[model samples]
Target: MEPLGRGDPRARRPRGAHGFVRSRDGLYRPEELYDATPYSTSSDARAYQWSSEDRSPDALLTRALHDESIDQALGRWCDPRKLVGVMGGHAAERGSQEYADATRLGRTLGATHTVATGGGPGAMEAANLGASLAEADDAAVDEALGVLAEVPSFRPSVDAWVDAAWRARALCPTPSPNLGVPTWFYGHEPPNVFATSIAKYFRNAQREAILLMICDAGIVFLPGAGGTVQEIFQDACENYYATGDKVAPMVLVGRRYWTETLPAWQLLTALARGRAMEDHVHLVDTVDEAAALLNRPPVSRPSAPDAR
Candidate 1:
């Protein structure tokens, strides 16, 4: 499959106060990351390589600068209060019910809010795919889904998986924009292509924090393993410390899975007790219910901190 272009010419570089340097180097555009043959030569691959091998002070400084640049861009363009995040496992295959549910959740939320995710494969990719096709009809979405099912997972071949997504992307030429915060730390899980705007970082901790913080409208936790659980409590901690007006809703889908399987809901509910976030926390049976709960007016805007 043919890769995308190297960079976005449409992006305006941020000029320095002295009008000499372009201060904001900016994050990799979707095209920039995907462009090249054999995935190894792609910008995503090269960036991960550098992040993995580098240890010099200059490299650290550059990584910090790059992440800060991305933060500045997000600040200027996206309304953090309107961002709704979806957190789930990366193992959900494309044709699976879990993937389909995440996709529907994203489409529904994307109708009103900008969908955001961890930006890797599985549920993250599904949500991004749904958001991208938010403006399309059901038939078009179904067609795209069918196209993606050809390559369900990124395991055997990430290139094949990406190609399938690219094929699916054609169904919605003018895709609804969405945000993705991926990290190089998890290099095994390549970033998905459906995220129109990707804010990829070298540090996973910074990426996770930024992803959770920007979802001011709140986050919907899809059934997932360890990573999803971490997001739930991380978001809960933010809401737990937030004032009454600043607390964002946290909706967890799959009551039985969370309560019986993982049993995180018990602790989550207990933690919400006697706090401003008590009423904001909810347990739902489906993504439909989660979307409905988060469809209300947005809470106070949460601050988006720089990666440094």
Candidate 2:
């Protein structure tokens, strides 16, 4: 099927001012939009607390506003050609080797491309934290990781998780602009705040599709489970049919992870051969390899709304 938002005029606008204030100094507080609780405790994210009534009317309206506003802000600021996406598990905790590697990738990618993620904790937050710490030294990463190690996972407590992330940002204060597209449909997973701009929505399907559409440069897959596997084929199918004038790279990081552990690399490769997506597929061991392959030439726009 054709990707959603094809020939969308609103998707074509280039970067411009969004509806709210953004700071290049440090990670801004929870996005102050339809909901003021992005900075509040994680428990505040649930729809149940949205209004004096049930989480119905008010919550629904807020979601509509967020969807529209997020679409606008993304079009105004995103350059799909320079956008790189990293998909991975939401379980990778701070101080782990996996988290460290993902962070390193984010820092390096931040030097050129604007990093984007699913906007949750685990590997996603680690990548965002990496880009945020690029200007600092490794010691900064360690110190910040120490802070995040407090909760380790957002599953335990979203509030604690975000508190740790905010503390991490304060300790480092590295100014790297990143984008996060999260959905409230997965209410359990609070949106990660590593990105300077967050386009949070209520529709999971729209969020998933937009996330893939905006990744014109390419997407890197780290170790993950069912959801990540679904994404691999979703992107592959799009490439097989050749979306737009481009078939963005789909590089899998961690040879062992993608090959033996998750075993999606072989399937991805087999699907690519003799297909339009053949050249765009790659497999490597390190984050640097993933970034290098993904940053190569011919990264083109998708069939989605073209940004100005």
Candidate 3:
């Protein structure tokens, strides 16, 4: 490939990009690096790996501005009012049934709603992959999923993992409606290749809030650890406070995983009892059911418990 940026007209040369060039859709592809370093490639993960000098105070401000600009651009690409997020563990991997189920949910939701993600691997990648594949057809998704099944995890090495993903893309280069909101704070985890529209940020807090706020329709929660749990509560807290004037659905994908395994679902539902967000809190056995929850109208935000 003729140096990723040199030959491609689409490669942007930003005025104050600070080593990060926000491309037409995905993360910036650094023009300086030779060989396919993470930053040089279009991989979302590379956007988080800026050198110390590149992250100097002056550069950080510029990068922050660039991230904001990218978010502005994304607002034009899809209706923020129709976004539905899929939240889950970044370690879910490719071949597992959990990953496969997430992919199906993305395909289902992406057909009618724009799929949003935290923009990392595991379940995030599976869902974004599904949304992208859905742009073509169901058979295309099946073929790509088979290719990914051969090399399931990126933890072993991103090179082999990325290679398999590229092979799948070559087989099915469908337009993707998956919007990824990733941050440099978790750069080691690399942004998954699936989201065609990525909003990479330097601030993790802002990214998290934006991901939850923009998903107007709802969010789907998969089995996860601390971070995912934190997200659930943060989102719930916001809806409880009616901070944004609207509260969306919060659907848990695995019934057993949410109830028996974690029990966070019980806590959330209990808190939501007799409240407006109650109708929006759903526990489903399949991806289809989760998608169905989004397809319906969100419940009104009832009067929250007295904060006093």
User: What are the lDDT scores of the predictions, listed in order?
Assistant: 0.83, 0.69, 0.73
TM-score of each: 0.88, 0.78, 0.83
Error of 1 at 234 (Å): 0.9
Candidate 3: regions farther than 4 A off: 1-47, 51-55, 243-245, 301-308
Ranking according to lDDT, highest score first: 1, 3, 2
**20-106, model 3: which lDDT tens digit per residue?**
453334333222111265433633434444532375665666566666765676667655447889999998878888889999988
Per-residue lDDT of candidate 1, residues 1-101 (tens digit)? 11222464423443222221123445456777888878888878877776787676666666666677777877665754489899999999999999999
What's the lDDT for residue 259 in model 2? Answer: 84
Per-residue lDDT of 122 in model 3:
91
lDDT score for candidate 3 against the true structure: 0.73
TM-score, ranked from best to worst = 1, 3, 2
- Which residue pairs in model 3 clash with each other? 45-191, 276-302
**Model 2 misses residue 306 by how many Å?**
23
